[model samples]
Target: MTNFNGFQKLIAIANEYGIICYATPEECLVASLPGYDDFLLAFSWSGAFEGEPPEHELIAISIQDITKEVTVAAWQIPTYLFGNVLRQAQMLVTAHQDFVLRTNNP
Candidate 1:
């Protein structure tokens, strides 16, 4: 089940952004865009039912800095929505990096 190519690519994105990147047997990857103080993304593999494998789930988590409390936002994206999430992350991270670069340069 974990052999899915898309899963590997998603995990690669997590690694690229230096998120909490350790793959467990439960088959999950977690990530956050670099520029934000309170944001998170996670992918989890679900067990198959009947003969068809279950679609993986992508969710957003919110965490508090002081209290260390976690709250998962209301989102459960299937494979179809994966690209949108990935694209959003890329855009955000890139913009923030550019901002930091300019700030440092000046």
Candidate 2:
């Protein structure tokens, strides 16, 4: 698969959990979800494919909470774990949203 196809596959996996990601001009995958938008979640992969990706290659998933001006989450894992990591990321974003909402309301 070409790099675009690889990114598209990743986008599809992220969409399964309602996270919308698109390729930026810089060739980075960025999330533009509601609660997760401010976090600027960006994914990076080097030579990852949908079928039998290189074991040595790692995908970096990171969330930088721009609202709080800090990075709240970051993870580097093999391509095979992409789906699992995306699920965890969705949970993390939900938790952060809840925390911010409560803090603001209280």
Candidate 3:
């Protein structure tokens, strides 16, 4: 079970990657990133359920108006790897945020 602090770290990471992360009652985390012109990378994740457990997966979608394109990538990570990914993402976000901050500051 992840604590609030951990979740906050995840959000920070997403922000750094120029992605937006939102939480829904049904979905644990939803991440979205705009790519190129209209293309986008959207991903959602659900840790575990009450009765039946679901696998941890990542999905990437590409939107191109009428010609819609989609790609999916799913994988299961061990409990140990979960923290590492989360931390890495957080580090990326922190670095991105720092870069932007420095660039904007005179």
Alpha-carbon RMSD of each model: 8.6, 4.9, 12.0
Candidate with more favorable, higher lDDT: 1 or 2: 2
lDDT of 3 by residue, 1-106 (tens): 2456545654554566556657656434555433333223333332544564332222222222212343322343422234344334344444555665798995
The local lDDT score (0 to 100) that residue 72 gets in candidate 2 is 67
lDDT of 2 by residue, 1-106 (tens): 2487666766776677566778777776788545455767787765545676465457778877877887667888876666576567668887877987999999
Under the 3 Å rule for N, CA and C atoms, how many clashes does model 3 have? 0
Best by TM-score: 2
Predicted structure 3: lDDT: 0.42
Q: Assess each prediction's global lDDT (C-alpha) against the native.
A: 0.51, 0.71, 0.42
Candidate No. with top lDDT: 2
Per-residue lDDT over 3-105 for candidate 1, one digit per residue giving the tens place of the 0 to 100 score: 6775686566555545655565666665554455454555654432365433444343222222234432324555445546655654554565577579899
Per-residue error (Å), model 1, residue 6: 7.5
Winner on TM-score (1 vs 2):
2
TM-score, structure 2 vs. true:
0.58
Off by over 4 Å in 1: 1-22, 47-67, 86-106
Ranking by lDDT: 2, 1, 3
- Name the lDDT value of residue 27 in candidate 3: 35
Which structure is stronger by TM-score: 1 or 3? Answer: 1
